[model samples]
Target: MTLVSQSNEESTCERPTSKYAQYTGVLAATLAAFSIGTYLSWTSSALPLYNKNDTLSVSDQEGSWISSLVPLGAIPITIPAGMLADKFGRKRTIWAITVPLFLCWYIIAFAQSKIWIFLGRFVAGAACGAASVVVPMFTSEIAEQSIRGLLGTIFQLQITAGILFAYATAFTDNLHVIAILCSVAPALLLISFPFVPESPAWLVMQGRKNEANDVLKHFRGAHYRTETELTRLELQASEMREAKASIFDLRKYQKAICITLGLMIFQQLSGVNTLIFYAKKIFDDAGSTLSSSTSSVIVGAVQVVATYCSTILIERAGRKLLLFISVSVMATCMFTLSGYFHFQNSHDLSSVSWIPLLSFAVFIVIFSIGFGPIPWLMVGELFTNNVKSAASAATAICNWTLAFLVTKCFQDMVDLMGISSSFATFGVISLIGTVFVSTVVPETKGRSVEEIQIELYGTQISSIPRETDPEV
Candidate 1:
């Protein structure tokens, strides 16, 4: 009857004394995140080479299609990726991501025609779409509540790191070398991720309680038996009632869905990708003294540093505080940048030549700290386990959809309305996002999935109590 006694399933795997063992799956997922980052930014390097008359000689039309195809390809795959993650297991779906991702890099590395590059970009986009869903869900299900926020943000951090890798590689003259180098990320992930544990929550749902307990023990260490964590997970599984998760079922967690989808929309509408896709052009247009490539590298470096900063501060300052701050600061930065552009367009550029560079640098840092990382991190935290896969997929699709629209329209908006007007439009969206976070989005730091759902439900979700909520 002792809670501490070893079951037959656990006897084969000795319980460890360390807490760090819990993060093995997180570490493995972080590798996949690196690959996602590479997918996102590799184009920055490759596109220039494709434009070379002696190279692929892509027309402007072909170049734009190559760039936009990623999110377009991502749109269709997200829901399927989510379903696969839930049904087959998070670990397996992640393993599958490596194939398409590797193919993406290798195709680009060896491509002689725009057609091959186009197909490569689509495959890369599919892998990114899959990773977007699976990594957060896997990380959420594996992490201890105390460190969940910290671990979840690592996804974004690795993405920043991957982007930086690509930006740095742009210094090399050979585009093929850059693509081949990016290939190393997925190749490493494919080789190493098998060592990571399958999600304990998924195992419990599969009715493999003993195996779940053993995995939980690995994550939580020797003291695991004394905790109610395993029982709570089993109860969560039971409460799900073998319900087949569908996109329609999201209505059950409407508040959670609204906040998640709202954040996704706001995040994209705030024009993060617009700035990223045209960092060099923005610098050149602004007449920066720094080389465009250097400015881009600086932007990438700032993002990586700022994302890591958010990872550290998130668990401490809390999600709501950081998000509010990020949105407010980003809006302010956009308005400032807008003003700079307006002045540059209308007046002498001598007085405020420094403004654009400074504004963009600060903007990248502010973005990396909150708006960049928290939305995706919260996707993993905001839902009940039953709807997690479906909800995450839906939100990711919305994310990619907006990303596509924004990237496609941003240049035209600048051309039609002016750079100042386009940025001003984004500024308005960021301000609205600030209000949304302040009014609707609940703080989720240090809360369990069940606890967060109950808070959102504003009722007894099963027997979990409102008064006993630790994260309140």
Candidate 2:
């Protein structure tokens, strides 16, 4: 039956079973990631000696290295995780993803040496890499087209929320306690996620048609293979599985691959993570009367509230409009921050220190709403079946690599050019990103993966319009 017939004739349809079941997996993914996100983003600000000692002291880079190394590990792990997700079911992939992280947490919590700290950081980072690629792809495949943006964006939305909650948790817990708390999160995957169904798309790829049918039935609460549309999804999955996607396979889809990489890199350049991890230092240098810890808390709170705002608007306003608005807002914040810091450089630090805190608050809020959530959705929607696996791997590399640079280099950059120059540089980058988004970004809101594939990578290899973005 067609969607028209099923919708019009079925009164007892009782809604799709997966409508609710879908959240089971995403909620699990979100909880695991949110816990990680909070711990990763806030711990730098919350680390006991950070504010107690000047960053110039260099006595405790080991603690900061723990947070920075997480993003660095994503570079090497993304490609392999994507491949594993393809080989095993998403469920099985997730099953193995967090095992090493469990051990990493215990080490990180108690390690005294820099080497041991880096070891834990690298391992936990690998676990998150697997989860990031698999969970979003899984969410995209299972979600209905109507609410896809909402569901997809929710992962990122919660990540920002996670940053806030993690920062707040710092008020009470020390590093060891935080590590223990963060370590326990992945245990949920061990206990609760097994009861959830595997991604039906993965089942189709394995030629397990009978299993796919049963899984679909469990999710949709209806008999499987009722429509050709549903069967087409299965066939698409089967066709792609046969394609033998690999690192070299990605080069064939160069333009789409570039777009994916650009999406990830642009996300980092927006200064969202920089603002989160370094907000305390930014505020301290700007001469905020508020203590660094208090200022950091304010910044985290702003991000959480703004991310929630994005969650509300994503489905209604659509992806393009929101990204445009978000980038514009971010640019505004960056400029404001630059101006504040520039003024501080010329005047006494105490006279205008409050300016940086206010501007940083604005920056975090703008970042939380648009740039924060849109990039993940863009990447999730950009590629066709042939290239998504490879593209996601490449994109994950771009995500982690740039994140590492920002995380690892923020302190060095501050030392070299001063905070005023750092904020100025980021402000300029945000404006440049606004231009990139205007030119290349496609409107993926409500489009199916197949439709988005055609939109982004058609026969003649045309590109999306720069002015097609919402703000332009």
Candidate 3:
């Protein structure tokens, strides 16, 4: 990521050359590590109680804060998670979380009491908070400027894939099935710990300047980024040298704090986690006895595939364009499902049954390709290194806080408003999300971090993009 500063050149927006494949491999490992966040919480959907009774006292909707609770649980942990990544190497922070993540799932699998479940979920969510900070920071540091959007999105894409995998195990009553399945992710991630290198930026931060060069050898490909690139990274790290914000502090980076909150709140408003946790029930409402677990699997699979396609297409289409296409499709699907449920009521279930299920499946596909992957990508890239951690924590708070509200209210919403109206309400939210993405978001497709700063904060676009691509 050589910053061609004076001329305002952005990196060549070209796709990765064949050499970036290794970086892509590292991206996969980081993605799997990152996905423990989703996998840990997603298992709540398959709770033995929820599968059968779903009684108010046991698996009741009002009682189900555990699903979204972790994201909220994760809030207090985010700044520390980020600081750890900045202070220690990202791999170290990520590696440290792996054990707790595995154990939390195990406890959830076996826990007999709600107290135990809450504790387990709280712990698991904390691990996710750590991951949310570590993975993107690591990815951004390692990925080519040319492919950052695509690389950045891999985290979300894999998260969708993890959900699909979790839903795939929907049928079994045994907790081990879910536990062992979720455990497999961290187990694999643990293997990458010994092999993958540390974040170059973190190394530079620790004043291991000479050691930073060695790690950079593995992280960067033969097309050496110019000296200016290294200098910019060092300069960014220097700004943070004396800057440390405690978990209790929020005043220093107020703008980042607001944006983080907004990003998380809006991301949840897209109704993604609600749809995921309740995909089966939503299908059931639409007139399909298709086993809630089965519906989950189907939705999960579609999301996984759609996200993969997002990675391939995000660069070609540009971030804003892809987001518009995805949000439009999602909004359409939302309205279609909402109307089907609204009109159908309890009358003649035979008529409106299939549309909601079909609509939901379509919604999953649309979301993954656009809104699902893009939100996290944007949030990760939105903040500069200085406030990135605090911002991520704040956004995470909004994400989980709304997630808790949505998860807790979903069944109540179903009980009060009926399925159709609830879906309609969500559809309207998607339209709002579309509006926000269009007017507020800028094109950061191939921009350097500093260049993005200039564009968003009125600095200036970098020179790389303006300078002709040698490959072209």
TM-score of each: 0.84, 0.83, 0.79
The digit string of per-residue lDDT tens for model 2 on 1-472 reads 6987877655445346446766676777666577557546654445554446453122435545655888877667777777788778788787787677567777866776657767877877878777788778777766666666667766776676667666665665466666666666667667777887887777777777777777767766664333443587777866765764566755546666666677677678766677777665565566678887788778777777877787777668877777777777777777788777777656676766676777778767766667766676565566655655666677668878888888777767767897667767777887777787788877888887667657656642223433345854
Candidate no. 1 TM-score: 0.84
Candidate 2 local distance difference test against the native: 0.69
C-alpha lDDT score of every prediction, in listed order: 0.79, 0.69, 0.66
Q: Give the total clashing residue pairs for model 3.
A: 12
Candidate 1 lowest-lDDT run of ten: 8-17
lDDT: which is higher, 1 or 3? 1
lDDT of 3 by residue, 43-120 (tens): 445643445643313555534566666766776777677767666677787788877877887887777766787788
Q: Residue 82 deviation, candidate 3, in Å? A: 0.7
Q: Candidates ranked by TM-score, best first?
A: 1, 2, 3
Candidate 2 weakest lDDT stretch, 10 residues: 459-468
lDDT of 1 by residue, 1-472 (tens): 4545546435424334465875666877778788877777766666666666575687655665676778878898887887787689888999998888887887878887878888989888888888887888898888877687678777888888998888778788688789888888888888888877789989988888888887887777755562366678878877776754678867666688889889988899998887776676677778877776787788899888888887678668889998899899889989998988888866888766777777888888988878777887787788666666677678888999998888778767876899999999999999999899999998888888877867777663544433346743
